[model samples]
Target chain A: MIGEWIRFGITCLLLIAALVGFTAAVIGAYRFGFVMNRLHAAGIGDTLGIFLVICAVSVSSGSFLEAAKAFLIIVFLWFTSPASSHFLSQIEYYTNPHLYRYVDRKIQDGPHSDEKEPE
Target chain B: MSVETAYDYLYTGALIWLSVLILFMLVRSIMGPRITDRLLAINMIGTLVISCIAVLSRLLDESYLIDAALIYAMISFVSVLILAMIYIPVRQTRGKFEKDARKEIRAERGIRGSVTESGSPEYKAGKEAEKPAYEKGNAGLDNGRDTQQDASLQEKGGSRT
Candidate 1:
């Protein structure tokens, strides 16, 4: 009975930590000035928040199969989240004409060099 | 309370909080300024929902819900990938069109300037203004110096008279 209570305590703590992570991500999404900055914030929730929640579930579920499946979810997300962030950043770079206003970029010798030409 | 009851209460409270967070993310996506911002919010919403599912799985003593969350993760990742793919080409083509239009306008402006030799004063002024004063080889400074010299010369001439 005491062991069960101990497990319950740990689960509750993990759940609270996950909730805090999600709350921070939400606040960051709202408060960040740029899309890239917001992406950084979202990454926090994607990684730490989900990890904690799954950890809690795995601890409380007490079944090897469920724990294994939870582990799979974590692995999948760990691999894919960075890829999605990269793609999102690429979209921001290609779409935003004013990206230089936000990020420092070296002007390469190409069509981009003609930006200062009077039109 | 029994461990079962305690677990039930904890999971229930967690699910409720997760739902609230998801609702907040939904509003963020709706209010997001850029396409990336909306996509980011959607991604976060997917993550929150996955956690909710994981919690629910434990609450209900079911393992299939974990599988459901896994599938949800895969789908969300693919959705972001596909949407980004769709948007990039469209943005690139639109950028190409704008660039072409700008090149045409520049060519036209060049032709007019060469043929007339005295192109529109406003256009000339705009072009001049596009360059910084320092890059103009200190022309304003030179003018100021010249005016000062002329003023001194006039004062000397007046004194001599």
Candidate 2:
């Protein structure tokens, strides 16, 4: 009985975290533009939060096969996030030098500062 | 969503925090000036993303997040290598450029182009000083060549006689 109660309590916690993460992601996306901050927010607001929620769901579902599937989705996302982000950043950095210009970064102290002077 | 266990709550809380962390990394990456700085931030984001999926799986009472984490790790590693390959040539070329510039400056100042040519890059070694060593070396080479010509002419003349 105690075990069952504990399980229920845990499920509630996972649901709440998921709700928060999802909310944060949406907010970040809305405020920062889909590509600008969506990926960033997803890193923490979606991916990590989702992982926690999945664990909770798996344990609660009490089905090995179903739980495994949830775990797999989380795993897939985990692997893809870094690879995609790296590639995205590389593309932005090399092909589109304009990202720096639009990002509001302070290049004053950087080596590129010399080039930053009013053209 | 019957999260009926301590694992559920712990996993949920963990996921929330992971998402928070990944967001930070993402911002860092976007703001970075250098390639590696962005890459490092991206790497951190990937790790956090992996962690997020893992936690989300628990919260959602599923088990798919693990696969995502593994894939993220593999892909990120490969991507970083690609970035390095793209920039390596640029770095090498700049090094060569600096060497060439210094060489030209040294030559202008009456110094040798390379350290192997002699020593020191002190280019402004005084204008047109006409060093004794320069005259001596030129004179020696000229004298040797003249002697060789004279000997050859003398040898030809004696043969004809």
Q: Against the true structure, whose lDDT is highest? A: 1
Q: In model 2, which runs have C-alpha deviations exceeding 4 angstroms?
A: A33-38, A102-105, A109-119, B1-161
lDDT of 1 at A68: 92
lDDT score for residue B150 of model 1: 42
Q: Is the docking of candidate 2 incorrect, acceptable, medium or high quality?
A: incorrect
What TM-score does structure 1 among the candidates reach? Answer: 0.71
Q: Please, what are the lDDT tens digits per residue for candidate 1 over residues B1-161?
A: 89999999999999999899899889989988788988888888888889999999999998999999999999999999998897777535555554554456447645655564333466456544533343243345443354345435645765786
Residue B159, model 2, lDDT = 73
The CA lDDT at A48 in model 1 is 94
Native-to-model Cα distance after best TM-score fit, residue A65 in candidate 2, in Å: 3.5
What is candidate 2's lDDT per residue for B1-161, written digit by digit as tens?
Answer: 34245655566566666666667667767876555546656655555565565556556644555566556656765766676566545433443543454345435532332332222224214211322232233343442354345435645765786
Error of 2 at B43 (Å): 18
Interface RMSD of 1: 4.4
Clash totals, every prediction: 0, 66
Best candidate, DockQ: 1
Clashing pairs in 1: none
